[model samples]
Structure formats: C-alpha cells, structure tokens
Target chain A: MRVIFNEEMRAVADDLDTMAQDVRRAINLSCTALLKSDVEAAQSVIDGDSAIDNLESSILDQCVKLLAKQNPVATDLRVVVSTMRLASTFERMGDLARHLAEAARRTYPQSAITPDAMPLFTQMGDFLTVMADRMVSMLADRDAKTAEQIILSDDQLDALHHKTFDLVLADDWTGSRQDLINVVLLARFMERLGDHAVSAARRVVYIVSGFDPTKEPSRDEGTDID
Target chain B: MRVIFNEEMRAVADDLDTMAQDVRRAINLSCTALLKSDVEAAQSVIDGDSAIDNLESSILDQCVKLLAKQNPVATDLRVVVSTMRLASTFERMGDLARHLAEAARRTYPQSAITPDAMPLFTQMGDFLTVMADRMVSMLADRDAKTAEQIILSDDQLDALHHKTFDLVLADDWTGSRQDLINVVLLARFMERLGDHAVSAARRVVYIVSGFDPTKEPSRDEGTDID
Candidate 1:
C-alpha cells in the first residue's frame, strides 16, 4: 500500500508538471500573438485552453481518489490538498493566457497595445513568461527558494502593469477611447496572470515548509491596481 | 464518531454562511460607495475584507481537520472538498468588493461611472447584490435550483458588462482617459464578481447532484469579454 501510494503521488506530480508545461506554452503563445498581432497564434491559444482545463479536472479526480483510498494524513494530506489548489491555479493561468489571446483576436489587424504602450506590455509579457517557467520548475523541484523567487519576480510584473496604466493615462496620450479601454483591460489580464503565478508559488511554499504563506498579508489585496 | 463528524461539518457550514454574509455586505457597501461616491463606505469595505479572508482560512482549517480525523469518504469527502472551494470563491468575491471600493475611493468626490454610464452600472450592482444574497441562501440550503438561478443571472451581468464596454467605446463618450480606465476596471470587477458567484453555485450543484457542472462548457471561457 505504501509503495502504491508513493507511485500514485508520483503520477499526480507528473500530471501537474504536464499541466504547468501547457500553461507555459499558452502564455508564450498568447504573448507572441499579442506582440506580433498574429491571429493564428491567438486562435490556437484560445482553442488549447480546454486541454488545460481537462488536465485540471483529471488532477482533481486523482486527488479525490487518493484521499478516499489512501487515507493520507499529515504532510501527505497537505500534498494532496495543495495539489488540487495548484491545479486550479494553473487552470486559471491558462484562462488568463486565453484572455490575452482573445484581446489579440478582437483587435485583429491592429495590435492590442499602442506603439507608445507596446514596450511596457512587451516587458510584462516577458516577465509573465519567465514567471510561468519558474513556476513549472518550482512545482517539479518543490524548492522553496524557487518559489520565493517567483514571488519576487511578480513585483516586476506589477511595475510593468503600472507602466501600462501610466502610458494610457499620461497627459500626452494619443490613444482613442477604445484604445484606452483595451489597454486597461489587457494590462489587467497580464497583472492578474502574475498574481495567479504568485499564488501558485505561495502554495508551493506552504506545502514544503508547512507554513501557510497565505496567512501573511497579501500584497495584491486592496491595492490601487485591481 | 459519526455524530462528532456531523457536528464538525455543521460548524464548517456555519462558518461558510458567515463568510457569505460578509461577502454579500461587502458587495452592497462597495456598490453604494461607487454609486454614491461614499469614501467612508469604501474604506469600511477595505478594512472589513480581512475578516472575510480570516473566515476563509478558518473554514479551510476546519475542512482539513475533518479530512484528517473523520477520513470522510464518498459524499462526505465531496462535501469537505466542495466546502473548501466554496470558501475560496467567497474570499474572491470579497476581494472583488474591495477592488470596487478602491475604484470608488480612488475617484472619490466623483462617481466612478460617468453620468451616462451610471444607469448601466447601477443595474449591474443591483444584479450582483441579488446574486450575492442568493449565493448566501444557496450555501445554506444546498439547493441545486438556486444554484442554477445564480448561473443564469450571471448572463445578465455579462450583458451589462458588455454594455459598459459599448458605452465607454462609443463615439459620443466624453469621459477623460482616467474615467475610461476606471469604468472598464470597475465593470470588469463587477462582472468577475458575478462569475465567482456562479462558480460557488456550481460547486453546490456538484455537491448535491454528483454531476460536475464544471465539466460542461464554461460560459465564461474563451469569450471576447476578458
């Protein structure tokens, strides 16, 4: 029974790694589509989101089965519960990628970010891509240090999000009302993506250190940036 | 042992009820703040969000303890897992309220919605407040019918959200760029509040019916609305 439980746990971990990879790919594809105005890439990201969603459900089912059959307790139980949460977080990250793609698709033949705001968005995309990759690694290794780094990197993403806001609201801004609306929503999608990544990292810290980092004051809460 | 487990489950349910009430109040207060430009109401919502968060943590701790001690299987297991998800959903609803309040506070002395857009937002707020109230009741009764109603109402919320987009992007829109940004973010926050409410409702449906409504096509997924 112990051997089977360990193997099943390994299988769950493998599934999570696969889900993380899919999310990373979705993020990268969506960012590329947004930056280059590639509708095909955007459409692909939109189409592929369901697979990520399916993976989350599969992971959840596995966790529920493990809890029912194995009766995992203490650290083992925490791992199962946290796995469910991590899967949900990754699923949401995939949705954010799809939202970015939708923005790109909606604005087809025209870039979502205006010329003046493109640099800020480009930086935001890069940060999110890196964050996604780090999250994948952190899940695999279960290293608290990597998780901490992902949390720190989210600060940079937040800064870029603020830059996008500033660019839209600046005195000399030349974007139309539609452009203003799109920029605000797009930046918010990217910022929320970063927030979910931070959340996933915190869960890792919780599972490893047995200290719930979520109990601490959440930096994203009640902030000026939604 | 069964009686003890039953009692503990009821405690979890009661805590969820409290959280839902807090979320409902937050929604009403934040909307009042936004529509009325009430800075103090906004501040109160912001200050009170931590209590909701604390309730969520408490509920999670309770659920985890139940899982470890009772070793609940089958329906009992689903109840515990679903309760955790529901608590997370309510916590997110509280955050959305705080976000709305922050929008109001940021634009204090002036309503977040421009005069022309006020009616639409007012209706949106009304729908969300009702949805929150129903969500609280649904959590208590675990009624699938009420859960379905919450899901349907979210469509109205989405329509209102799209209406806000149209209003902001219209050629006649005279609001400043800041106004446009605030309107978009605020509308998105409200729409997301509806979405979370729908999520909590679906979890209730899952618990009651043993048919995962989440497996069905997600209404919010891959849409033009971000």
Candidate 2:
C-alpha cells in the first residue's frame, strides 16, 4: 500500500509538471501575440486555456482520491494538499495568459501596446516567461531556495507594472482613452500573473520546509494603483 | 473516535461561519468608505483585514490538523478539502475589500467614483454586500440553490463592470488620466470580488451535491477588458 501511495504521488507530481509546462507555453505565446499583434497566436492561447483548467480539475480529483484511498498523513498529506493549490495557481496563470491573448485579439491589426510602452511590456513579458520557467524548476526540485528566488523576482515584475502605469500617465503619452485603458489592464494582468507564480512557489516552499510562508503578509496586496 | 471527529468538523464549520461574517462586514465597510469617501471607514477596513487573514490561517491549520489526526475519508475527507478552498476564497474576498478601501484612502477627500458613475458604483457595492450575505447563508445551510443564485448574480456584476469601462472610455469622459485609471481598477476590483463569491458558492454546491460545477467553463473568464 505504501508503494502504491508513493507511485500515485509521483503521478500527481508529474501532472503538476505538465500543467506548469503548458502555462509556460501559454505565457510565451500570449506575449508573442501581444507584442507582435499576432491574432493567430492569441487565438491559440485562448483555445488552449481549457486544457490547463482541465489539468487543475484532474489534479484536484486525484488528490481527493488519494486522501480517500491512501489516507496520507503529516508530510505526505501536505504534499497532496499543496499539489491541489499549485494546480489552482497554475490554472490562474494560464487564465492571465489568455487574458493577454484576448487583449491582443481585441486590437487585431493594431497592437494594444503603444510604441513608447513597448519596451516596458517586452521586459515584463521576458520576466514572466523566466518566472514561469523558474516555477517549473522549483516544483520539480522542491528547492526552497528556488522558491524564495521566485518570490523576490515578483517584486521586479511589480516595478515594471508601475513603470507601465507611469508611462501611460505621462504628459507625452499620445494614446487615446481606449489606449490608456487597454495599457493599464494589460499591465495589471501581467502583474497578476507574476503574483500567481509567486503563490505557487510559496506553496512549494511550504511543502518542502514545513513552514507556511503565507503567514507573512502578501507583497502583492495594496500594490495596485486602485 | 467518531464523535470526536464530528465535533472537530463542527468546530471547522463554525470557524468558516465566522470568517464569512467578517468578510461581510469588511465588504460593507469598504463600500461605505468608497461611496462616502469616508477615510475612517477605509482605514477600518484596512486595519481589520489582518484579522481576516489570521482567521483564514487558523481555519487552514485546523483543516490540516484534522486531516493529519483523524484521517477522514470519503465525504468527511471532502468536507475538509472543501473547507480549505472556502477559507482561501474568503481570504481573497477580504483582500478585495481591502483593495477597495485602499482605493478610497488614495483618493481621500476626493471620491474615487465620479459624480456620473456614482449610481453604478453604489449598485455594485449593494450587489457585493448581498452576495457576501448569501455566501454565509449558503455555507451554513449547504444549499446548492442559494449557491446557484450567487453564480447568476455575478453575471449582473460583470455587466456593470463593462458599463464602467464604457463610461470611462467614452468621448465625453472628462476625468484626468489618473481618474480613468482609478475608476477602471475600482470597477475591476468590485467585479473580481463577485467572481470570488461565485467561486465560494460553487465550492458549496460541490460539497453538497457531489457535483463539480467548476467543470463547466467559468463565467468570469474572458469577460475582462484586456
């Protein structure tokens, strides 16, 4: 029974890895769509979000089944519960990517990002892609250090988000009201994507160190312009 | 042993009820702050958010302890897992309230809602307060019908969110760029608050009916502007 439990746990971990990979692809594709106004890439991200959501549901069902059958306790139980949370976090990350894709699709033939803010958004996209990759590595290795690094990286994303806001609100910004609205929402979506990645990394740290990092105040709180 | 498990489960339920009540109050207070530009009310909401976070942590700890100690299975196990999700959802609802409060605080002595958008924001605030109350009732009763109603109500909130965007982006909009940003974020925050409520309601439905409503496409998805 113990052997079976361990194998099922491994299967669950494998599924989480797969979910993270899908999210990474979605983020990259969505960034491409947003930066280049590629409607096809945007459509692909939108169409692919359901697969990420399905993975989350499947991971959750597996965790519940494991609890029912194997009855894991202590650290084993924490792993299962943490996996459930990671699935949800990754699912949200996928949705953020899709939001970006939808933004791109909405402005097809004209990029949502203005010329002045393009560099800032490109930096944000690069940060998100790297962060997504690190999340996958952290989950696989279960290294608390990697998880902590991911948390720190989110601060940089927040800075970039604020910079985007400043750029849009500047006197020189020539975009229309619609353009300003789109830029603000897009920046927020990217910021939130980083926040969700930080959340997933924190769960991994908790699972490995048996310490609840969430007990600390969340950095993402009260940071939004609103 | 069974009696002890039952008693512990009851304690968990009671804690959830308390959390819901706290969220309800926070929503009302934050709305008062937003609508009236009451700095004190905003501060109260911001100050009280930590308590809500603490409650969520305590509830999560209790759920984890129950899982480890009692090794609940089948329906009992589902209850524990579902409770964890509910705690997280309620915590997010609290954060949304705090976000609204923060928005109010940032614009103290100057209201975040423009004169023209006052009625819309007031209606949004009322809808949120009502939804929070319904969540409390649905949790206590485990009534799937109330949960479904909450889900439907979120659609109305979504419509209001879009309307706010239209108002901000209209050619006649005279607010400064900063005003536009503030109004859009505030509206999105309120819309997201409703979305979180729907999520909590869906979890209740899942716990009661053993049917996963989340399997269906989430209505909140793809609705946001960019």
Candidate 3:
C-alpha cells in the first residue's frame, strides 16, 4: 500500500512539472507572436489559455488530494503548497502574455511603436522568456542556487526598463506622440512580465528556504530615484 | 484537548476576519487620497499599508500553522486555504490603490486629469470606492449576492472609461501631448483598479462556493460596446 501511494504521489508531481513546462512554452509562443505580429500564433496562445487554466485547477486539486490522502508533512506540504501558488502565478503570466499578444494583433496595421522602438521591446521580451524558463527549471529541480541567480536577473531587467523609459520620453515630442505613449505603456507591460516571472522564481526559492526573497530588500528603503 | 483546539481555531478565524477588515480600510483610505489629491491622506495610506502587509503575513502564517497542526479535512481545510488566498488578493488591491495614490501625489499642483475630464474621472473614482466598499462588506458577511453586484459595477465603469477615451481622442491633441497621455493613462489605471476589485470579489464568491463566479452570465458579458 505504501509503495503504491508513493508511486501515485510521484506521478502527480511529475505531471505538475509538465504543466509548468507547458506554461513556459506558452509564454515563449506569446512573445514570438508579439514580436513577429503573427495573429494566428497569438490566437493560439489565447485559445490555449483555457488549457492553462484547467491545468491550474487540476494542480490545486491534486495538491489537496495528496495532502488529504497521503498526509504530507513538513517539506512535502511546503512543496505542494508552493507549487499550487506558483501555478496560479504562472497561469496569470500566460494570460498577461496573451493579452499583450492580442494588443499586438490589434495594433498590427498602425505603427503604435515605430520600428525604432522595437529593439528595446524585443530585449525586454527576451529577458522575460529567459527568466520564465529559469523559473521552470528551478521549480522542477528545487534548485535554490539557480533560483538565486534568477533573482539577480531582475536587477538587470530593471536597468533595461529604465533605459527604455528614458528612450521613450526622449522621443515623446516627435510627431506621433500617441505612438510614443503606446510604446512606453507596452514597454512597461513587458517589464511587468519580467517582474511576475521573478515573482515566480521567488516562490521557488521560498519553497526551499521558507522565506520570501524579495521581501529581504525593502522596495523603497534606500531608493532616491524619485 | 479538543476543547482547547476549538477555542484556538475560533481565535484564528476571528483574527483573519479582522485582518480582512484592515485591508478594506486601507484600500478606502488610499482611494480617497488618490481621488482628492490629498497628500496628507496619501501619506496616511502609505503608512497604513504596513499594517495591511503585517495582517496578511500573520493571517497566512496562522493558516499554515493550522494546516500543519490540525490537518483539517474538507470544508475546514478549504476555509483555511481560501482565507490565505483571499488575503493575497486583498493585499494586491491595497498595493494598486497605493500606486494610484502615489500617482496623484506625483502629479500634484497640476491635477492628474484635465479640468474638463474631471467629471468623468471623478465618476470613475466614485464607482471604484463603491466597488471596494461593497467587496469588503461581502467578504465580511460572506454575501455572494452582494459580491455579484460588484461585478456589474465594472460595466458602468467601462462606459465612463470609454467616454473619457473618446473625449480625449476627439480633442485636437496637439500641444502638451505628454500631459494628455498621462491623463489617459491615469484613466487606464483606474479602470484596472475596478477590474482587480471585481477580481477580488469573484475570489470571495469562489471561496464560498468552490467555483468561479466569473463564468456566470453577468448582464454585460456580450454587450457589443468594445
């Protein structure tokens, strides 16, 4: 009986890891759709959201079932609960990416952000995809060290985000002010995507260390940027 | 021992409810400060965020402790899990309100929105406060019916948002495009606030019913208004 129960629990964990991988793929696909203006790919990302949603619900249900039937304790309970929360955040990240793709689809004909602005936005997208991929790896491996590296990646993202903002504002007085504004807003949205991925990575670290890494540095404690 | 455990459980539940109430008040204070451009009030809201943050952490800790200690089953476990999840959403609402207030503070001496746009903007503010107030009440009372009402409030907000957008676009947006963009973006932020509040209410209903209330047909679902 014990061996069968253990096998079932292991299978459930493996399934959850696969769901996380699906989310990573969805994030990548959405980013591609955004950069390439592939409405079909963007539509697929939108369509695939229901699958991600269903996966989230299933993971939560399985975690609950495992806790109930197997009576997981200590590290096991933490791992299950952390995975549930991570799944929720990951699912939302997918939704946000799809939303961004939809925005790209709508703005395809008109140059909302001129081709000049594309490089920074593309960099932001790459950063987000890389961070998201690392998060998936950390979660699957319980890799505290890799999770720590992912946490550091957020600092680099912040610098690039500041540069993007400055570039947007520098060209704000140009003819297409509306386009400039849209570009800035879109850039901010991409930066937020990276932030959410970092948040997922933070959860992986917390799952192992039992402490929130981001809370370590007070967001405004020593910042005089304003 | 059973009696002692029951007493402890009741105490935790009461504390969790109080924390929710604190979150409610923090959101209201932040919203008022943002709409009124009241710097002092904004400062107060900023100060109040710590209390909300502390409340959320404590509530989550207690929930985890209970889960570990009691190994609750079925409804009892659900209640504890739901409380933690609801608190997470509530804390996010508080953060969003704080962001709005900060925007108000940053743009002071020259109001965030133009004078002509004030009426619609204030309408948005009023609707948002009502939505927040109703959400808090529903959470306190576990009133699913009232929670559903808050979801409908978003439609009215959307109408006002569209009106604001049209007004902005119809004007000869020539000079000070940056200012105009800020105003429009402020409106967008307010719209997002309404969305998040409705999301929180939906989560409340989910906690009570164990299903998503967002899937239910609201009157505004297919209203072709774009």
**Prediction 1: B-chain TM-score:** 0.96
Poorest 10 consecutive residues by lDDT, candidate 2 chain B: B217-226
Give the better candidate number (2 or 3) by lDDT. 2
Model 1 compared with the native: what TM-score?
0.97
Q: Write candidate 3's Cα lDDT for B1-226 as tens digits.
A: 4565467667766765676576556656655665667777667767776666666676777766777777777766667767777777666666666666676677775565667777887888778777767876887787888878987678898788777656766656443555656665666666766666677677777767877543443311322111
Candidate 1 per-residue lDDT, tens place, A1-226, comes to 7788899999999999999999999999999999999999999999999999999999999999999998898999999999999999888888889989998998999998788888888888888878888988999999899999987777677777778877877889998887887788888888888888888998999999999865877635224655
State which candidate has the highest DockQ. 1
Docking quality (DockQ) for each candidate = 0.66, 0.60, 0.30
Worst 10 residues of 1 chain A by lDDT: A217-226
Global local distance difference test of model 2: 0.87
lDDT of 2 by residue, B1-226 (tens): 7899999999989999999999999999999999999999999989998888998898999998888888888778878999999999898888889989998998899998788889889999999888988988998898889999998788888988899988987888798988888888888888888888888988898898887866887634437442
Q: Which parts of model 1 have CA positions greater than 4 angstroms off?
A: A219-222, B219-223
lDDT minimum window of 10 residues, candidate 2 chain A:
A217-226
> lDDT at B22 for candidate 3?
65
